[model samples]
Every structure is written in C-alpha cells, then in structure tokens.
Target: MTPRGVLGADELNNIAVFKAVSPSVVNITALGLERDFFSLNVQQVPQGTGTGFVWDTQGHVVTNFHVIQGASGARVTLADQSSYKAELVGAFPDRDIAVLKIPAPVAKFKPVTVGTSRDLQVGQKVYAIGNPFGLDQTLTTGIVSALNREIESVTHRTIKGAIQTDAAINPGNSGGPLLDSAGRLIGVNTAIYSPSGASAGIGFAIPVDEVNRIVPRLIRDGRMVRPSLGVTGGGPEINRALGLPKGVALVRVQRNGPAAKAGLKAFSRGDGGILAGDVITAVDGEPVETQDDMLTALERLQPGDSCTLSVWRSGATRKLTVTLAESDD
Candidate 1:
C-alpha cells in the first residue's frame, strides 16, 4: 500500500472531522489606513489575515487581538467563496480574542459548537482548521499534548494559557478553532512555539473556557476588566532562581489597594523570618506557570468581584478570599 503522502490512520480519521467544520471556518482580513501626512493623504490598507469561526448567526466572528489590530475595515470570507465586510464588534486584548460582525445572509453563517476547556485531557484527539498562509480552510490533526500551557502575551508583559497541540498550525492560522474529536471547538488557535516561522509540531490556542468567560464581557464593554491588588513584588525572580517556588514576595503596598485593604500581609527585610506572603501558585484552580499566568487570570476578574487566592505559607497551602478593588490603570 504505497502512498504519495505519509498519512496516518489518525490523520485520515481527523480529515472527516475537518471536512465537516471547514465550511464554518472563515479567513479574516483586517483593513485599515495609514495617512501620509497631517490630514493629508489616505489610502485603503490591509492589516493582516487570521482565521476565525462563525460564532453565531448574528455575525459574531471570534479572532485574535494581533490580527485585527488597528483595523479600520475588515472582511470575512467563507469556504464557499462568499465574502462579507466585517465590523469590529469587540475585542479583549488581554485574552487575545476579538469579535467581528459581518453583514452576511443568515444562511451563510453557521456557528461552530463550543466545547469546555476543563474537559480536555492530554493526548486527546484534536484537530485544527485554518487559513494557513492564505491557503483557505486547511485542516491539520494532532493530539492535545498539554493543557493549561502558557504562551507569551502580545505585550511581552504577561503570558496566557493556551491548549497546546501538535497540530500543524501556521502563520495565518491565528484565531482558528482547535477542535476536539466530536467536532466541538475547545480552543482558538493563537500562536505556535516555532522559531522557523512554520509549524514545528507545537501550536497553541486560547482555551474555550477562557474565551467563553471573556467574550461576553468584551461584548458588553470595549475591553476586558481585571481586578488589581495594587502591591508591587520585591524583585522576586532572584529568590525564584535560588531554588525556591516562584511568586511575588509582596514588598510594598498602596494604603488604599485591595491587597492592603483585604488584610493581605507582606514581607519586609527588617521583619523577615519566613513571613507570611501569598505564594500564589495558581488562581481559581488554574496553575500559574509564570507571572503572565497570574496576569491573565487577573484580566478575567473585575473590580468588586471577590476572589480566592491559593497561597502557600510555612509549608502549607491555604485559600484566602480577597475583595477586589478597581485598577487605576
């Protein structure tokens, strides 16, 4: 049984699922303008291309932040060759998801079924349908190599949890759906762990649970709302490098900050004897792999939303619920 390509049994099976969802996947093109001078010249421009799925019949298409960034005009093209101009409905840059609206006929927009990220097990069957390099509605299959994986944020200031897969995701694949075996959308393809700018068997996606939680808020507001503790960490990476568990050692506090107001204590060099600090290993049961993980979790909560912190102190882990205060930023 010689074949022209190295197609495996799993890949063949996944092709069926991909075929079923391909029509629902769309290629997103963001158009904008760059003026030549002060109130002078203007020309229509194309920003970038990313993949997205038909979120609903009302024309909500979900995508990534870096994709439609600075977009003045946008368009979504379906597999059936139908095209529609898109309007930026909403965006949450923190979660890296954007919702675009297209005025297409109701029949053309077929929404994909959403799945839970909490249910994904490592090595489970997963597939990706994307517009890789403008190749329109292409599919690649692989297993979920890991869950709750973190990828560097667009700002390089934080990291976001993504569903890691071995699926062949490429440059233009950002914002495409990462599907489970039952053809359900578990994640949105966001980035890759490749250095060669190609699919190196490591692709990442924004978890559907995160998406499900943030999209509604972004739709209501123009941005994702996050609660703040208003305490700065005391250069904790040095301690972290010396074989200690990682997290900020609370050094300074704002008198009116949520952390201070909630009675969350800190450690000072003069008063140090293994002082009690909230050694944050996780937030809301999601593991904090890095500082970015904490930031991403923080991005989901709003001021006045009470939250419980998983803290470690003196070799024991305890939960401390802290009432959130608004971030001045």
Candidate 2:
C-alpha cells in the first residue's frame, strides 16, 4: 500500500542520493588576467567556473584539467559554503583529469563512495551533481545513454571507453561526479556533444576505471607513465610524403634499447642512396597500420615483457623477438 500524501519510492531514492552525494561535490573558480581590448589596461577576470569532488580526506580534489588551465589561481567552495585557496598538484591533459590540494581540515572533507564502471548497463538511472551555470550544488537526473564511446582529449589523443549519458551536463558541470542510483561515483563528467554549448541530452564522462588506474600514479609521479617502443616513427603525413606503405618506419632507434638489441635498423644514407630500414608492420601478430596504432599496442604491455614484431625489410618480411624496456624519453 502506498502512503497517503507522500512521495513514491523512486522519488524518495532520488532525493536521498542528492543529499548523500552533494556534500562530496565542490564548486571551483579559476582567476586569471585579461587585457582590455579598447584600453591598454589589464583586469582581473574569472576565467573558469567548474565542479569537482573530494577524492580523499587529505584535502585532494579531482577536477578536469581544462577547468584550471591558464589560471593564475583557483578557489574551491564546499557544500558547507566554506571556500579555500586550492593549489594545483598535477594535471593529465591527455585524460582531461587534474588534481588540486586545499589546506582544509580533515573534518570538513567527505570523500565520495567510489564505484566501478566495468559492468554499467545502458538505461540505468544516473544522477549528475554539479554547479551548472554557477548554480551551486545542483542535481540533474538521467540514464546511461550509451557506453564505450570514444571522445578526444585536449591533447588530441583518443580517450577510449568513455561513458555517454543524457544527464543535463552543462558548462559548469565539467569535472563533477556522475553517480549511480546508489550515490556511488562512476564517472567524471567531461564533455558534451552539443552545438549550442548547452545540454542537448548528449554528454560524456571519463570512466572511473581509467581514473582509478591513473590518479594514484599522478598523485605520486606528477605525470602519466605510458609504455613506449624505444623507436621514433613518423606520422601519417610523413609516411605519405615519403611514399612508404601503411606502416610505422623506424627513423631512429635508441642505442642499447629494446629495438637496437633486437637488431632493428634505422633509416640511413648509404652508397645505394636512401637505405630503407625496418618498417614495423605488426606486433604480437596484430596489424599496426600507423604510428598511433603502434603506440596504442605498446600501451597494452609493460616493461620486461617480450613480444614479437613483424618488420618489412629488403623486400621481405622478418620476425624479431624484442624485450621491452622502460622508456626514459
């Protein structure tokens, strides 16, 4: 039996989620300077207003990199209306994530309940807690509109496995938490596929799984550690200009590196004019068409792992087993 003059169970659950997660969400303001166009004067400007959340009790806050980019300073406002000066710790523009530290008491911070995004289903109810258009602590409800969507980062790299939602993400909603029905953090709202710069029911978030893998590394190393192949290759433009086939040709191989140890040669000028060196065609039996593909394939492995590479040399194909080394460059 339903209670008289009371809300339904779904409505009650939504309200409870907003109350539980709003405390963890924060409003960020970035200050900068801009020169006036008409007069030769500089003025202080509010460059950005975005959202973030408490990652832990040690005063670390996580937000999008573009939120604080180019700002001279920033401030964080909490749910209790307490504001504090925030210091930029580190930023990963390739993943669109940044971390900030505030000198606030432990008692004032409430870390959000972290959740996994590995098994999220489409149409599951989700809520976005952000400060859209500078309206602090606003709550919007929607569903997981899609999954495994790819979005481009500020660094021009493709961020795979992005979560697409219809959760009314607006300008000030960047870096805010996208919570599940149970109020657990699943994704960080990053971009929207809207032409009008408003909520067109199409928004994207960085999956918490990638965030889980990268944030700790950022907190410790202050940068992302991506695996490399120890060889310098050219992009597609250079490949086309050289009239080479669709593959990453080694232009330079590091001395005593993995490729050098495996007898991989680099392009050189010899008696027979330009000597074409080894052009990498595949890795671990998977076809690599361009330099980006090679890098993406190498990212799946770590240092000290052995893999077989297929190379095209001297009008023939050859295989070489190379031991991966930690990249210093």
Candidate 3:
C-alpha cells in the first residue's frame, strides 16, 4: 500500500478544529415517561436525542429548548463517553435555547470559544459537530450559505438573524455548535429545511450573538426577561378586518400599566359601534408593523428603559414616552 504524504492546509485545519472543539461537544438524551399496558406501571424511556456543548466551567450545558421539551428528565454524555444526570437550569423558548446543569467537576469541561455572528459573510467556511442519528462526535464541514435568516422556534416565535449553513445538520444535531474556521462557536444548530426530515443541504443555526445575549439571562433568571408596554394588541386578522394601518392595534391595555399610564387607549364598544384606539406604529423611532416586530424592537431593552412610542390615535399620529416594565409572559 502506498503511504499518504503531507496533508493539505485545509485538511490540517479541519483536523485541528475537530480536535480543539470536539471535547466541548456533548450528547443529550431526553427521558420520557411511559406506562406498561399489562401491569400499568410507569417507567422512564428515551424520548429523543440531540447534541449540546459545555457552556462554562460551572457545568452548564447549552442546547435547544425543543431538545428537552416535554421530557421527564435528561442525561448528558461528555466527549470521553462519561454520562451524567442533567438538571434543567433555565430556558428561553423564544430563541429555542436552553441551559442544563450537571454535577460534574470543572475539570471535565472544556467550554467552546464563543464568537460573534454580526460580521459573518456568506460563503465563509463553517463546521458542525453533533450526534446525528444518535451517532456521537461526528463532524461535518460546509460554508455559510446565507446570513440573517429567520427561523421559527418551538414556541412559534420568529428567531431572526439566524445563520444559514450547508453543514449537514440532521435530526440529532439540534443544540450543537456551529463553529467558524478558527473553531469558535458562531451559532447553535437548530433546524433544517428538508421535506423528508433529513439534511437537504440547508440548515439553520441560532446566531451566537443571540445566544450570548440570552444565555446569561437564562442562567440568572431562568428565562428571557423581556420588557413589556403592558398592552395586549390584536392579531393581523383583526388589523386587516378593521382596515387598520400596518401596526399593532391595541385590544386591551392593562390598567395603570406603562401603556395605560402613558395614556394609550384600547378598543371599546360604544352605542354607535366599535371605537378605534391607539395603534403603536413604532418603538424608539423603529417602525414596527406587527406584534412580533414590536417584540424584536424591544428585545434589547430592559425593564426600566424609557422608550418613545409612535402612536396613531383618532386618525392622528402622536408620540408618547412610556417606561417599560417586566413582562410576565
């Protein structure tokens, strides 16, 4: 047999990346409860499987919220094939991200090097490490097929600014890390655009920028702490039926809440007919055409932040400053 010579630069880089980042990757098994038909005894069973990575030395493992959703329990297996019981720490379903903690010692963890996604360009080299089809420690390489893509979360919320890559992400790849050429974590593999539920050369990852923003909060608060204007708005159908402009039409405003305190009004029934109320057209000068748009606009804000809302009331546009408050939702 002929001996292979020196490896190419790209091949060496791939090998280096796989070696550097693979230790941070872990396999997740979701446990569910089942009942035996004969004895009617309840037992724990394997519900699903996915991939996750070590978040920090504190034994926090980050993965997609959908991976552990509805599971009675979960287990995490490190790169060395050592398994540990994981406890749900926190989750932000709107971004499809979740955090779990294991009692493993800090020496067993090698956290992935986090990277930013704001400057990612299309066609750049990327890699995905996951446990596809329950096969652990598999590495696939591809390029950034697109950027700033939108994908829906398990909660049906729009996760904007997603990184689209052709990295061969599969069913069990959920919550795995998508790394750059430098082996830095750039995104979290979440979904694929395939009709047959297999990789079709199109995969989506939650950008690391979003992950960086939400993970710490989840660790601290156990959920995404979003600010609210304290108003319930009508859906798109209601807006279309009423022939309203492209904005969030207020359906109900919480009494003495931020919006109500700012004099925002809600739709009311009168003897004549339904009375139109204030419609929020913008937040802090950013145009918001839908409720989701408004939420995205306020995503970066905190509970005590003050924002100017562009409101349409009685056919005239006006500006109202409202102090935001913590949202219960």
> What's the CA error at residue 173 for candidate 1, in Å?
1.5
Q: Is candidate 2 or candidate 3 better by TM-score?
A: 3
lDDT: which is higher, 1 or 2? 2
Q: Residue 4's C-alpha lDDT in candidate 3?
A: 95
Checking candidate 3 for backbone clashes, the offending pairs are none
RMSD of each: 4.7, 4.0, 1.9
Q: Flag regions of model 1 displaced more than 4 Å.
A: 1-16, 34-41, 132-135, 157-160, 238-246, 265-293, 310-320
- In the range 244-314, model 1's lDDT, one tens digit per residue, is 46665565667878777766666554554454555566777876645555666777788888877776655
Which model is ahead, 1 or 3, in terms of lDDT? 3
> For residues 1-329, could you state the per-residue lDDT of candidate 3 as single tens digits?
99999999999999999999999999999999999999999988889999999999999999999999999999999998888989999998888999999999889999999999999999999999996444459999999999988999888889999999998999899999999999999999999999999999999999999899889988998888899999888888877887878899999999889999999999878999989798899999999888898998887788999999999977799999999999988
TM accuracy, model 1: 0.79
Worst lDDT run of 10 residues, candidate 1, spans: 268-277
- Off-target runs (Cα >4 Å) in candidate 2 are 1-4, 34-45, 133-135, 236-247, 266-289, 293-329
Q: Clashes per prediction?
A: 1, 0, 0
lDDT of 2 by residue, 1-329 (tens): 96688888999999999989999999999989889999969876777799999999999899999899889888898888888989888888888999999999999999999999999999999999996444468999999999999899988877878999998998799999999999999999999998899999999999998887777777886766666668998677756766777778888998888899889988777897778788898999988877767876776666778889999886789999998987774
Error of 1 at 253 (Å): 2.3
* lDDT, candidates in the order shown: 0.78, 0.87, 0.92
Residue 180 in model 3: lDDT: 97
